[model samples]
Target: MRRTTTVWMTGGLGLIAAGVLGMLRDNLVGSAGAPVIAAAAEILAAAALLLFAIGTSRESSVVARRPLGVIALVVLALWPFATQFIGRLLSPSEPIGDLAWSVFGVASVLVPAAAGFIAAVQIARADTVPSPWNRAPLWVFGLHVVAWVVPQLLFAAVGADDIQGLAGLFLTLGKLAYLAGTLGLGIVAVLLANRRRTTTVPVFQSASTDRD
Candidate 1:
């Protein structure tokens, strides 16, 4: 792979790891853990943005026309906005003791719920490229959305205040799905990077060289 391609690939994987670790920290970490989790998520999201910018830059060697490339760009662009939207949606002025628990409801759960649908549509399109790993991530990530979102929506719609009661559930199951999806995405990123790299390789022999 070209140096640029390697950088993009590495950066993307690192972002994926950061996002996953952030979700864990946000959900599992307590008062002491808050800053660390939030910081990690911020860093990951920032790295994703940086890599996306470089990948989308005119100077980047990777072709933007490819389907996976397009999806990666779109995902990176939307990720931060999704997190911001969730933060706004969940913000409580009074700051209940367990209120910090709701962060997963928006961050881990809702954002993926929306993004998974978007990814599914893109993957299903006729013009989109196909790969076993890419398709798996698309589907699995979409499913992870369900795993994370349903319980939170159920509890929230009922106006349940026992956030502690559900905290463990969301922290365990919700985070598992979120981490899985992020890891899957990282795998897809690597695959896409490899595909992008191989696309540039030239055939060593001409078609006419084959024996009759």
Candidate 2:
């Protein structure tokens, strides 16, 4: 098995850890909450993206996918750090509304979304013989989008202040759903890598058949 396969699988595991951390952070209420824990989520997520990109780049059969993976990882890696900068910019005098952080947030999500799509396309369009895991690429992209966009829309539609009854329930549900989706992406990645290992068996299989 290629070392990169293990790398991708390991990265996926890290991503799941990140999502779990995020969910754990959300559960913290009142004074129990800590931003550092949430920060760990982003840091782990970025590391996962980078590791996955490296694995994809090492795959000999995949061509167009490499550059797209690189682009996606770059955005993913930078995503967590942006929040810190945005935080620093916010003050009593310079409020969130006064700045363009909202726009920045929206655009930031789009960057990974676009790159995910591109990389998925590359996996889909590989010129060589395809692996059963090829569809896994699309699954990775899809889950990532679900994690980002679905929660964003759900939370925004029901503002935090407006939540008196079902909104709070939905807010919690949305957060869980986002984490589940993120977890799903990692699961898919590891499964896909596992499946990829079988691709090498055909050569041995054909040789055995020839001998028989």
Candidate 3:
């Protein structure tokens, strides 16, 4: 396999592993090692994001050519670490710290959401990637944002206190959707790598000698 393909595959698998770790952490909540598991999940996620960002930038000049897009991808990749740093620096129990964290938390979501959206659009526009598959980023990131925002909007509109059970249901559904979207991104990455491998032809191979 080509070096680029290997990078893509490794990054994709890393994302899948991170998602599984996240699931495990969620299930192990309240257990003795839950904090450890959660920390592992975050670390794995950050590394995976960095790898994926590198792979994407390598694959498409569109992403690499634009400074803003590249910056967004780097920011997205570093988000997990940023969150961890903020958590350590600020005590959530204090009112000022809590407010600071609240603002940062919102930025954590919004900034990444915006970055992902920009990356997805750029990837979709790049001719280097195949049609339809190029659009996979949109499905992965767009669904995530939709899943996150819809429930909050609905809960606010209906008044969370008025329908607590409904609110819980919405929250649960949103989490499930988010999980699905996360897994979907990994799957899409693997598929894209496979597609590239199957479609690519080595420059050294002549047309007559090249096998289908």
Candidate 4:
């Protein structure tokens, strides 16, 4: 019912679908077509998040805003990182710029991820807020960080040469992490979307209307 819930639910589901696609590459689907499906899913998820970030302000009704506002903005910024890699996948030889750029850029996701953590805490600390952020659940964002964001950061840091004998081991872990994060986000979103909140009518207003 709530816009926040709707958007978050969609964002979460998108992430989960993307994660499933990411894993299919190694399964019966085989490596060739699976990577393409995964890439498409990732792009779709990223694009959805980017669009959802734009909705935060509109959903909040252009208010003075809160920390979640910045969180949305940062999340919007984070999606572009995926596009760069996606571009590389589509055209590897075209040079998507330095890999170092990707490493550092991907790390920026930590900013919003941290912000989301703080926002979730803030919600827990306070009460009686308006829409756009009120009653929004965010533990899933942390899951996303643990599952995908952390792995990306580590992947960037641990080059092929650095892994040496542990390449396959870490690579598999990295892939698993992404899948977990995406699915976690999706589940959280769906839970939030279906959540129910009790609304109480003002006693005075009810009495006044009855009296009339």
Candidate 5:
């Protein structure tokens, strides 16, 4: 396989592993090794995001040609660290920290959602990837929105009684959606990598034939 293809496959696997580890960490909270699992998940997710950014930027897809799409991918890749690590470390009671947390919280939701929407639209319009695979980004965006909104709606509807159980159930569902979305992204990346390899072979052969 080509080096590019290997990168895509490795990144895809990393995403899958990160999702699995994240779920495991959630389930194992307060357990002996929960912190370790959480750290592993965070590291894997960051690595996967970087790899994906590299893969998308190098690929010949229509999305890669669009400046907005590239910017969105880069922003999405970096936003997690800001929200997950740096923001979390800040004390919410302090003025500067409070402002930072507010910015992080809003940006965490809006920025990613906007970025995903932009990327999804570009992916949907692109003909480089095959039918459903091309629409994978759209699904990721849609599911992500659902994951964020549904839990809140459920909480609003059900009220505070039995909050723990209801919250846990919806949160798990949200996590499942997130997992599915990540899995979809991984599949799409692999598909795109294969598609790139397949398309390039014909051009090379055609070039060789013309010289013969």
Candidate 6:
């Protein structure tokens, strides 16, 4: 394996270990403050590994899907952090009508904007072959969108007094979903990488025999 590939796979392994530990804690009492935090960290780690793996892959010679995916995942992962900044801008007594409008505006705009960013990356690299794991990022993105939506609906249902509260909830869901999807997709990417290698041998062997 190439140096970068080896490094990435190693990173992926580390992330897998972290995720497992997090899961164990999740099952146990006081595993962590919240399941989402652990999950998000794991996803970010996995994404890092996947990015390296892509850098190493021969397929990446033409296109670096892993990098593209990584960027998307990172954006999704940091999504929750944005709430903190947004909250500071709003006054404590902001009207629900204005708050709701603003929240909806950002969501409607940002969600697709993020997705489009990822899609654009993929589209730019359409000429290259994508590893199975490349698709994993998109899955995370999809869930991220749902994550963004659920809290809004919940807030609307409950009639939250503060838009900041609603924003916090949305961020929480989005972060959790982002992490879960990242870990899941990371596993998928590793599996795909291995599977691709496994399958390549037979084709190479057949070609060698034919050449002989």
The candidate with the higher TM-score, 5 or 6, is 5
How many backbone overlaps does candidate 5 show? 0
What lDDT score is found at residue 152 in candidate 3? 75
TM-score against native, each model: 0.53, 0.65, 0.78, 0.50, 0.75, 0.51
- What C-alpha lDDT do the candidate models reach, one value each? 0.57, 0.64, 0.69, 0.53, 0.71, 0.55
Candidates ranked by TM-score? 3, 5, 2, 1, 6, 4
Q: Write the per-residue lDDT of candidate 1 for residues 114-140, one digit (tens) a residue.
A: 655554544444232344543654676
Q: Model 6, poorest ten-residue lDDT window?
A: 57-66
Model 6 agreement with the true structure over 1-212: per-residue lDDT tens digits: 33433444554565566565555545564645556656555555645544543455544422344456545545544454455455666664766757765775678567646744574356245443354444554556567668767776777787757666567667567547645654564465456456556766788899999999
* Stretches of candidate 3 exceeding 4 Å from the true structure: 60-65, 91-99, 200-212
Please provide, for model 2 over 129-186, each residue's C-alpha lDDT reduced to its tens digit, 9 standing for 90 to 100.
1465556567656655555565557557876665354556557555755565467667
- Winner on TM-score between 3 and 4 is 3
Mark the regions of model 5 whose C-alpha exceeds 4 Å error after superposition: 1-4, 56-62, 93-100, 191-212
lDDT comparing candidate 1 with the true structure: 0.57
**Error of model 2, residue 69, in angstroms:** 3.4
Ranking of models by lDDT: 5, 3, 2, 1, 6, 4
Tens digits of lDDT, candidate 5, 78-107: 766667676558897787886887777787
User: Considering summed lDDT, which 10 consecutive residues are worst modelled in model 1?
Assistant: 56-65
Q: Who is ahead in TM-score, 1 or 6?
A: 1
> Which number leads on lDDT?
5
Error of 2 at 21 (Å): 2.0
- Per-residue accuracy of model 4 over 83-198 as CA lDDT, tens digit each: 46655555434475567457545565555566556545544434323444443435445445556554456567886566465557556656655655466545655555555211
